[model samples]
Target: MDQDQQWLINCLNASLDPNHQVRNFAETSLQQASLQQGYGLALARVAANRELPFGIRQLAAVLLKQYIRKHWNEDEEGFEHPIVPSNEKVSIKGILLASLDDPYKKICTAISVAVSTIAHYDWPDDWPELVPFLLSLINDQAKLNAVHGALRCLALLSSDMDDMMVPKIVPALFPCLYTIVSSPQIYDKSLRCKSLSIVYNCSSMLGVMSGVYKTETTALLLPLLQPWMEQFSSILK
Candidate 1:
């Protein structure tokens, strides 16, 4: 309702317009270096507003990601250190997660990128619960986007965390991956691919595959992977 928010929403909305010139103008305006902080907050508001057009909200999410990568923690250590304070950070996170479930799926990519960006700075410590929250989404029986978004985010974080964290994290992750990759009832090829990608990334970490080689983990893994062994064996030739 306020004039400032309305302007931000309008700019984001304009970015979604089909006309080339209008879209270009709105895109340029939102990226102005001098006004990034205000613009970023405004866009975060629009991104979180479920009532808005999904395209506009997607635009907001993308723009907010840019702000988060560049400006989120670019300040001194203290209560007001980060350019975006703790309270606002929490609010932005809530919005991004909600958008992950956006029925349209239009905003999934932006939200996933934003989450990965956050995970880079705050994981295993600052955000100990982050992995669990994303895991719940992957395990949820409903909503395809939740699984898709969660898988995308986990893979991104997997790249940053090597074996020290992987051993601890992989146990929780593989069970959900088992459900998706092995069970056809809820199976999705794209989800399966992302799940395997997570496995592959974990294996890349120094000691991660050694942990996976254990008897208990091997038992859980074989059933899910064995059914595909014939196909894999043929491919190996």
Candidate 2:
């Protein structure tokens, strides 16, 4: 590792130290470091590194999520957080999704939250490829952790998607969700539950959309309704 990365790892370790002074000092140093270019990407790398201690990795993941929230959008009206450099944002976004496959559940959850936060501001417009990229991961049965990570992100995003986004994502997302929820032998119960939750959230969004975009919403949901109902029945049983 480079000197900067090593120093970051040290700060992450110190932040978790029981000593108040040491932890405070480390946090101050980290806050200052957040202004530097590549800081977010560094935290991402540290979080994804399996060689690091679990606590350190988890802290890095959590900090990275906060970093994205604070610095991502420069144009938001009232936010005072400094804008993350555009080049750094591109670099960070590129690798951020891959970190979803981290074996540690906490790390994966943190990365998923980070992805959802980024998607909130960037999806479809700035991040045109987000849904397709996530769909690829969800469909990749070879990597269960990636699938879990993708599902976590989708679950979070589903709850808050607007009408335009609902139609764009639901048709693609429901089929994949159905695949996971229906295959009890292939997916764990928790993953199936998560898929069901996304379904619920998406269905709620569709219910709201039905009033305004009735024809489009109906066409989007019609084919999948029966199969989804069957799966829901199976789960209830």
Best by lDDT: 2
Report the lDDT tens digits of candidate 2 across residue range 1-237. Answer: 999999999999999999999999999999999988788989988888889898888888889888887888877644446688788788778777877777778889988888888888898799988889889998988899998899898898888798878888877888998899899889998999999899899889889888888898889889889998887787679
lDDT agreement of model 1 with the native: 0.72
Model 1 residue pairs with clashes: none
Clashing pairs in 2: none
| lDDT, model 1, position 117 | 86
RMSD of each: 4.9, 1.4
lDDT of each: 0.72, 0.87
lDDT by residue (99-211, candidate 1, tens digit) is: 67655555776778888888777777777878888888887877787888888888888888865687678667866776776655585777888887887787577344556
Clashes of each: 0, 0
